[model samples]
Target chain A: MSTATQTMPSVERVVTPGKYTFGRIMPEALKYFIVITLAISYAFPLYWMISSALKDDPQVYRIPPVLVPNPAHWENFINAWKSDNFTLYTFNSVFRYAVPYTLFTLLSSSVVAYGFSRIRWPGRDKLFYLCIGTMLIPYTVTMVPLFIIFKHLRWVGTYLPMIVPALFGNAFFIFMLRQFFMTLPEELSEAARIDGASELGIFFRIILPLAKPALAVVALFAFMGTWNDYLGPLIYINKYTMYPLALGIQKLRAMMSQVGNAPLAYPYLMAVSTIAAAPIIIIFFFAQRTFIEGIALTGLKG
Target chain B: MAVATAKKWRLSKRETQNLITGLLFVSPWLLGFLLWTLYPLISSAYYSFTRYDLVRPPIWIGLDNFREIFTDDPRFWTVVYNTFYYVGISVPLGVVVAFLMASLLNTKLVLRSTFRAIFYIPSIVPAVCSAMVWLFIYNNQYGVINNLLRAAGQPIIPFLSSVEWAKPSLIVISLWAQGTAVVIFLAALQDVPRSLYEAATVDGANALHRFWHITIPMCSPIILYNLVMSLIGAFQTFLMPYLLTNGGPMASTEFYAMNLYRQAFEFFRMGKACALAWIMAIVVAILTAILFRTSGRWVFYGGGER
Candidate 1:
C-alpha cells in the first residue's frame, strides 16, 4: 500500500516532465509555497521562544518585536536557573520523577504485556480485556481517591505517590507493548522453550532482545509523560523544593509576580521554558522514526 | 488404563503450571489494577454520595452533592458550558486542521520529513512549557501576537484575561498540538491505494472530486478516531487553562477537569469533587458512545462496500 502510494507521484513526474505548462507549474509552485508558509507558521512559536529566551528586557518588548536578539544575552538562562533554584528542581525532576518513573513503568509494563501477548493461561484473554477496559475510565474518577489513599499512607508531599504507582504497570503502556509483542512470531518463543528454556528465560533471551524498538518507544513515552506531567506533581508534591521542572517552572512564573519585574521575568521565564523543553526536543529529533511508528501503531491499532 | 490415567494427570499438572506462570508474569498489572484503578473507581463512586472534606470523615449525604451540582451551583453550569464549548470547537477544528495538514504533506515535496518534524515537534513539548510559551505570546503589553497586530495597525486583544478571548485562546493552543492527529492522518493517507485515485482521474474526476470522494472516504476511519480521541482529550483539558489563566478572569476558562481539581485540592471539597468526576466520566462515555454509534453512517472499512 505504502510503496504504491509513494511511487505514484514520482511516476507522474516522469510522465509529464516535458509537458510542464503555466497551468501545471503554477499549482506546483503554489503548493510548495503554501506548505512552506504553513510549516513556518507552525514552527514560529518555537523559534520565538528560543529567540526570546536569549533576548534582554528591551529586546523582548521592542515595538515590532525583534525576530532575533542583537547581543543574545546568554546570561538570561543563568539568571533564570539561579532565580528559581532551578538547579535543584532539575535534579528533583530527573531523579525524583522522570528516571525512576520511566525505568519502573518500562520494566513492569513490558513484563505484564509479555504475559498478555505470549502466555497461554485460563481467563487470560478475559482478564486482558478487562485491563483494556480500564483505559476508558477517566483519570478524574481515580484522582481524588488515589490522593486520599496516598494521604492516608503519608505518601503525599513525597515522590512516593508519583513513583510508587509507576512500579505497577500503566494500562496504556501495557496495551501498547502487548500489541507490539503480538506482532512478533510465536514460533521463536516456542523454539526457545523446546531448548530447555523456562518462560522467563524465553522472555529474557528471545523476546526482550527482539523487542528493542518497541521497548525504546515505551521508554520514550514514559520519559515524556514523567517529564511533561504537571497535574500529578501538582496534586502530590506540596513542597516547592520537591517540585518537578513542570511545577517548578509554574511556581517560578507565579513568584515572578512577587518580584514585580514583568519585563525581566518574561525573558527569564522563557529561558526557563526553553531549558525545560530542550531534552524532549533533542530526543524527538534523534528518535523521530521510532516515535512516529509508535504513534501510528497506537492510533491505528487502538 | 493405568498409563493413560498417569498421562492425563501429567497433562493437567502442565496446564496448572501454565496458569501459574501467566499469573506470575501479569502479577504487577493485576496488583496495580486492584490497588490503584479498581479501588479508586469504587471508592470514588461511594464518595460521590457523601459529604467529605479532607479534614473530616465522609458523611453520607445521599444525592445532595448531585442535587447541588445540578440545581444550585451556577459555577457548575458555567464550567459545563465551558467544557462543552471547548470540546465542540477544538475537536472539530483540530480534526479539520490536522486533515488539511496531512493532505498537504502527503504530496511529493522536498524536505517533506523536515516539515513533518516541524509540525509534530510542538505536540511533544511538555504542556507546561507550551503553556508558558503561549503565555508570553499572548502577553497584552509586549506579546508576539500583540506586536504583530500593532504592526498591522490593529488593536491588541487581551487573550487570556478577557472572558470572550480566554476560551478561544485555549482552543487555539489545543489546535497547536494537533500534530499527533496529523501524523495519524498521514499514515492513513498513505494507506489509500494509488489505483483508487487513478481510477477516479480516468473517470474525469478533478483534484477536488478525488479528495472528496476517494481520499476523504478512505481516511474516514482515522478521521473518526482522531475526532473521538480529541473529544476525550478536550473534555479533560486542565493544565493549559490552569496554568495559563488559573481558570480565569472570571472562571471563563474553567474547564470541567480544572473545576474538579480545584474542588478536590484547593477547596478540599472531596465529596463534591468525586461527584463531579463521576458526572464528567458519564458525559465522556456517552459522548464517545454517540460518536461510535453515528460513525457507521460515514466510516468506511477497507473490505466493505461503500
Candidate 2:
C-alpha cells in the first residue's frame, strides 16, 4: 500500500474507499461519547448523595429532582452529628477501623507474608497453599460457627471479635505481597546473608525498605476493607456504643423505619453517608498515584 | 561416638533455630488463624452435623441437619435458586460491561488517566453508601429516577421495592460497581501486542474483525480468570442485598448467604446455618474445580505448550 501510494498519489486517492474514512472517525467519536456518558453515570449517585444530604426533607423529594440545593443546609451535618451520637460513633469507628486494626494488620500480615515469601522451611509451600485455600472459602460459611465460638468465649458485644481477625494475615493480602516479593531480585538478600546479617535484620533493613510499594498497597486495601466492613461489626459488635461507621449508618436507616407516616429527615442520612465516605475519599486522593499503580500491577498478576 | 553425638547436636540446633524464626514470623497469623479461621472452619464442619442453638450445648445428631436442609426446609431450594439466578445473570453481564469499559479506556485518547479515574470513582464508595443512594433513586414516589420518568411522560417503575425488579435492580447496581473488574481488564488489554493490530490492519481486517480474531483470543485467559472470580463473588453476594432489600418484598432477594445470616443470627439456628454454609462451600469448591478444568482448553498462556 505504501509503495502503491508513493508510486501514484492521485491514483491511490481515487482507488481507496471514501466510505471507510467516516468508519474510522465515527468509532472514535462513539468511544469518546460512551466514555463521557459512563463517567457521568458513575458519578451521578454520589453527587445526588451530597445534594440530598444538604437539602430539606421536602425539598429532597421535589419533582424533576433538584440538582442543587437552594439554601445549603450545613446545619444538617451539625444537627446529625450531635443527634446521632456521631462523636461517640466516630471514636468507636476510629478505634475499630483505623487505630488498632491498621497497625495490627500491617504488623501481623507482613510477618506472615515474610515467612511464606522469604523463608525456606519445612512444609512452606504446603502451608502457603493452605493459606490461599482460605480465600476460596466464603465468609458466609464461617460466620455462624465463628459467632458461636465468640459467644462461647464471651467475646460478643465487644471490639475483640472484629479486631482480632485482622491480626491474622489476610489471605488476599499475603498472596498480593508474596507476588510482589517474588519479583524482587534474590541477589540483594543473598548479599545481606553473606554479610552475616540475621533474617530479621535483613527483613528490617533490606526487604522492608524495598517493599514499600507492596506495603502501601497492603495498608490501603486493609484500611478500605476494614473501613467498609459491615457484616463483622453487625454480627460481633452488638453494643450501640461499639458500632463502627458501617453499622452505625445502617442503624440510622433502622431509626428511620419507625418514624411513621411523616417524612423522616433526608439531610441527616445524607450527612451520615458523606461523613462515612470522607476518609476513603481523602485516602484515595492522597495515595492515588501509588494506589492506581498498585492496582494496575496487581490486576495484571491476577 | 562422641564425634557423632556432637554432629547430631549441631544439626538439631540449626533445625531448632530455623523453627524458632519461622514460628516468630508466623505467630501473629498463626495464633489468629487458629482462633478465628481454622478453628471456626473445622468446628463449623462439626456444627453442621449437630443440633444446637446459641444458648444450648451442641447435640450429637449426625446427618440430621443435612437431612433437614435437603428434604425439609422450603427456603433451602429457594435460596439456592435465587443465588444461581444472581450469579448466572450478573457474572456474564459484569464480564461484558468490564470488557467494554476496558476497550473504551484502552484507546489512545486524551485525558486517559482522568477517564480511568472517573470510571473507577464508583468503586471507591463503600457498598452500603451506594446502596443508600440507590434506595433513594429507586423510590417510587419521589425518586430522581421516577421524576425523570415522569418528565419523559413514562410510567414510574418500582425498582427495589418490587419483587419482579429486585434481582435486576441488584444486578444493575453490581454493574455500576464493575469498575474494579474493568481496571483489571484494562491492564490485561495493554498486553495484547500492538504488532497484532498492525498486522491485522495490513491484512484489510476491520476493527470488529480484528477484535474478534486477535484481541479476544489473546485476552481469553484473563477473561476466564475474571469469570471464575466474578462468579465466586456473585454467588456470595451479600452486602448490597443486605442493605438494599434486607432480603424482602417477601424474601424475593433472600440469597443463600442472606438466608444463612437470618438462620444463624436472627433465628439462632446455628446447626442449620452450618449445614447451609457447608452446602455453599461444596458448591463453590466444585464450581471452581470445573472452571479450572475447562479453562485449560480455552485460556491462552504465553508461548507455552497446550
Candidate 3:
C-alpha cells in the first residue's frame, strides 16, 4: 500500500476511504471534547476548592459562582491555620508521623524483602506467601482487636499504635520491594561476599544503594500512606491536640460549623483542605511515577 | 520463589548461618504476623463471641452477638442494605467511569500527561481533604453543582442533607477518587495489542464494535481486577460519609466501616463491633471468592492460558 501510494498519489487519493473523513474527524474532535468535559468535571472540585479558598466567605456563595476571586484572599490560608491548630496538625503529619513511618517502612520492608529475595533458607517461601496472605486481611478485622490490645497497653491516647506498626513493615511494601530485589543480579551481592563483605555490609553498602530508586518509591508511598491516613489517627489519637492533618482538618470543619457560627466558614474549610492537600499535590507533581507505580503495584488490592 | 536446595533439603553449616541471618532480617515480619496479624485476627474472632467493654473482661456469650445482629438489630440491616446499595452501584459505576476515562486518555491527544495527571491527582489526595472539598461542593445553598442548578432555574437539591440524595451523593464522591482505577486501566489499555484492533477494523468493525469486541475482551482481566479492587474499597467506604454526611439523613450513608467505628468506639459495643467486623469479613471473602470463581468466564488472559 505504501509503495502504491508512493508510485501514484492520485490513485492513492481515489482509493482512500471517503466515508471516514468527516466521520473520523468528528469522532476525533468529539473524543477530545468528551475528554475535556471529563477532565473538567474531574478537576473542578479541586479547582473549586483552591479558588473558593481565595474567596471571602460571602463570595463563596455568590450567584453565578465566582470562578476567580477578585480580591484573592490569600490570607485565608494563614487565617485557617490560626483558626485552629492546623500548624500542629501539619507538623504531626510530616515530622511526627509520615517521616518516621517512611524511614522505618523503607528500612524494615527492605530488610524483610532482602531476606525473602536474596537469601536462601528453609521456610522462606512459606513466609513470603504468608506475607502475601496478610495483605488479604482487611484492616477492619484487626481494628477492633488491635484497639483492645493497644488500649490494654494504654496506647489509645498516644501515637504508638500508628507508629509501632510501621517498624514492622507493610505487606504491600514488602512485596513491592521484594519484586524490586528479585530483578537485581545475584552477582552484585556475590562479588561483595567474595570480597569478605558481611551480609549486613553487602545490604547496607551495595544493595541499599543500588535499590535507591525503589527505596524512594517505597519511602514516598510510606509517607503518603500515613500522611493520608485518617482511620489510624481517628482510632489512636484521642486528643484534638495530637490529631494529624487528616483528622485535624475534619475537626477544623466541625469547630467552624458549631452553633452561633452563622454562615458556614466555606473559605476556612476549603483553606484547611487545600493546606492538608498541598503536600500530596506537591508530591504527586514531583513524584508522579510513585503514585502511578504504587497504584499499579497494588492494583489487585490488599 | 524457588530456592536451590543443598543435600536434599538438609542444611549445611554455611546454609545454617544464612538461615539465621535471613531469619534475623525477616524477624520484623515474623513478629508482626504473630502479634499484629494472627493474634489480633484470632482475638477479634474470639471477642465476637464475648460481651466485652473496655472496662470489663470479655464475658463468654456464645453466638448471642451474631444472633442479635441477625434477629434484633434493624439498623444493622439498614447498614447492610446501604453498603450493598453503595457497593452494587458504586463499584460497577466506578469501573465504567475509570474505563471511560482511561480509554479517552489512551487515545492520541496533545498535552496527554497534563490531562492524565489531572485525572489521577485526586486519588492521592488525603481522603479527609477530598471529603472536606466535597462537603463544600455538596452544600445545598452554595455548592457548585447546586449553584449550577439554581442558575438554570432548577430547584436546589440537598446533597448530603437529603436521605434520598445522600448515598448517591457519596457515590459521586467515590467516583471522583476512581483515578487509581483509571490509571490502572490506562496502563492495561496501553498493553492491549493494537493488531487486534486492526484485525477487527479490517473485518468491518466500527468504533463501538471494535470497542465491545477487541477492547472489552482484551481488557477483561484488568476490568476484573479493577472490579475486585473497587468492590473491596467501596465496601469499606468510611471517611467520606463520616466527614460529609456522618451517615446521616436517616443513616443512608452509614457504611460498614462507619457502623463498625460507631459500635466499637462511640457505643463501646466491642463485642457487637467484633461481630460486625467478622460478618463483613465473611461477606467480603465470599464476594471475592465468587468474583474469582466467576472471573474465569469473563476474564480473558492474554495468550489464552486459563
Candidate 4:
C-alpha cells in the first residue's frame, strides 16, 4: 500500500509515434524540453557549491566565476575541518545529537506507539487523541518556557537542552509509528500473550523486528532534525566549544574571515558548508529507498 | 449516580491490571506532558501577561504586554507585515511550483528518479548550508550572479543588501527548499488513478480538463494538508533569514519568528516574547481553522466525508 516511490512506466512512455504531425509532436517535445530544463536548473546550485568549494581563494573572486576548479584545492576541506575546530563540532553533532536523539526517540516513541496501538485498555484512544493535540501547539508557545526551564536546570550550555527531549516521544513520530503498529494483525500479539509472553516481550521480539522501515523513518528524521537544529543551540549555547555543526559552521566562517584579515573567505566557507552537508547526503544516497518511502508515507498518510 | 455509571468507573481485577500495564508503557509521555508540554503551555500564557527578565522575578502587568505590542510597537507591525508578505508570496508560489514539479515528475520522463532526487536534495540539505550557498549566489558585488551581470555589462542587483530585494531574496531561498512539498504533491499526483485519466481521455477531455476535474478533485485533500503544513512552517520561518541576511538591509527581512527570537534572546524581553508567541499561536489557530472551514468548498474528497 505504501510503495510511494514505485515508478512504473506510464501509458505515455510507450506511445506509438505513428505519423509525426505538428499538433501531435509539439506538446510531447515541449513537455520533455521543459522537464529537462527544470531538472538541470534544480541541480545547478549544488553543482555550483561543489565547484566553488574546490577553487582557491582568488579563483572564487574571479569575474565570470570558475565552473570547475582547475587544480582542485582538496586541502580546503582539511583546512575547513581544522578551522574553528570543526573536528569538535562534527563530533558534537554525532555524539550530542544524531546517536542519542535517534536512539531515544525511536525507543520511547515506538514503545508509546505500541501502548497506544496494541493495548486495549480504557482511556487509550482518548489519551492518544490528547497526544496528537499537542502537535497543534506551536513551538513558539513552548520555546520561551523551555528555555526558562533549561536555564533553571543550568542546562543552557549543555547537550541536555536538546538531547534530553528525545527521551520523551514526539507526538508526530508516535502517531506515525502507531499507524504502523495498528496494521499488524491482532492475532499475532494475542498468540504471543496466550503463550505467556509479556507485552514488552511481544513488542521487542515480534513488533520491533517488523517495524524497521517505520522506525528508520522516525530515526533518520530525528537524526536530521538534531543535526540541522540551529535555533535551539543558538539560544542555549554561547560557548563556541559546545556548538554543533549547524551553529559551528557560522563560527567557522567568522574565524576564517578574521584569521586571514580578509572580509570573507568564500571558498573556505563553501568548503565547510560542503563538509557540513556531506553526512546527510551520504545517508540519503545509501538509504535512498527508505528515505523516499518515508517521505511518501508521511506525506500521504499525514 | 446510576448503577451503570458507577460500574463503568469500576473495572474487573484483570482489566485493572491491563490498565496498569498500559499506563506503565505510556508513563514517559504522561510525565513529559505534565513537565514539558502542559507546564510550558500554561506558563507561556501566564508569562505573556507579566514583565519578566530572567534575573528579576516576573512582575505581573495584565494585558500591558499585549497593549504595548498592539498600541505602541511599530517594529511589531513591520514584522507582521514582513511575515505576511513573505507568506503571501512564498506559500502559494511554492504550492504552484511544487504542483508543477510533481506533475512533470509524474510524467514518463527519462531518469525520473534521478530528476526527483535532484529536485529533492536542496530541501534536505541543512538550512545553514543552503542559506550560505545562497549568500554566495546573492552576494552583491563579488557574488556569482553579480559577477555574471558585470561580465555581461548588465546592471548588477543588490540581492540581500537592498530593502526592496532582501525579502524577495529570502523567498527565493525558500522556493529552493520546497522539495518536501513537491514530493508530497508528487505522491498525491501519482495516486491519481490512470483509469480516471483514461476515462476522461475517451470522453474527449483535454489535459487541462482532466487536471481541473479529475486530477484536482482527487488530490485536493492532499493539497489542503500540504497547504496548512506549509503555512504553519512559513509562519515560523527563522533559520534561513537568520543565517543568510540576519534580518538586515534595514531589517526588511525580520520575520515574525526572527523578531520573536530577538525579543527573547537579544532584548531579554521574555514577557514580550511570550506575548508575541501567544499572538502567533492565536493567529495560527485562527488561520488554520479558517482554512479547514473554507476548505469544504474547494477541497474535494474523492472519498465521501473527506
Winning model by TM-score:
4
Candidate 2 lDDT, tens digit per residue, B70-140? 89988888888888999989999899989988887776667877777767767877777787888888888
Task: Please give the ranking of all candidate structures by TM-score, highest first, separated by commas.
Answer: 4, 1, 3, 2
The segments of candidate 3 whose C-alpha lies over 4 angstroms from its true place after superposition are: A1-20, A300-302, B1-9, B198-206, B303-306
Q: How are the candidates ranked when ordered by lDDT, highest leading?
A: 1, 4, 3, 2
Between which residue pairs do clashes occur in model 1? none
Q: List the residue pairs that clash in candidate 2.
A: none
- For DockQ, the strongest prediction is 4
With a 3 Å backbone cut-off (N, CA, C), the pairs that clash in candidate 4 are: none
What's model 3's lDDT at A133? 80
lDDT of 3 by residue, A1-302 (tens): 01110110111001235666876688778988898888899899999889998888678777878898998999888887888777888888888788888888888899999999998888898999989887777788999999999999988887788888888878989988887787788999899899999988988988899988788888887888899999888888878778788888878777777754544388888888888788889988988866676666555222
The parts of candidate 2 lying over 4 Å away from their true place are A1-20, A261-264, B1-24, B30-32, B304-306
In candidate 3, the residue pairs with backbone N, CA or C atoms under 3 Å apart (3 or more residues apart, or in different chains) clash, namely none
Interface RMSD per candidate (angstroms): 3.1, 8.2, 7.5, 2.2
The digit string of per-residue lDDT tens for model 4 on B1-306 reads 487477897887877888988998888888888989999988999999999999999999999999999999999999999999999999999988998888888877778788889889898888888877888889886788899999898999999889999999888878878888888888788777778888777888888898899887888888888888889899999988888788887879999999999999999999999999999999999999999999999988764432
Clash statistics: count for each candidate: 0, 0, 0, 0
Look at candidate 2 and tell me the lDDT of residue A161.
Answer: 78
Runs of candidate 4 exceeding 4 Å displacement: A1-17, A257-264, B1-15, B304-306
Q: Local distance difference test, per candidate?
A: 0.87, 0.79, 0.83, 0.85
Over A122-231, each residue of candidate 2 has an lDDT whose tens digit, in order, gives 56778788787777778887788788877888998987877777777787787777776676778887898899899899888988898888888888877787778777
Docking quality category of candidate 4 according to DockQ thresholds: medium
Residue-by-residue lDDT tens digits, candidate 3, B61-115 = 9999999999999999999999999999999888998898888877777787788
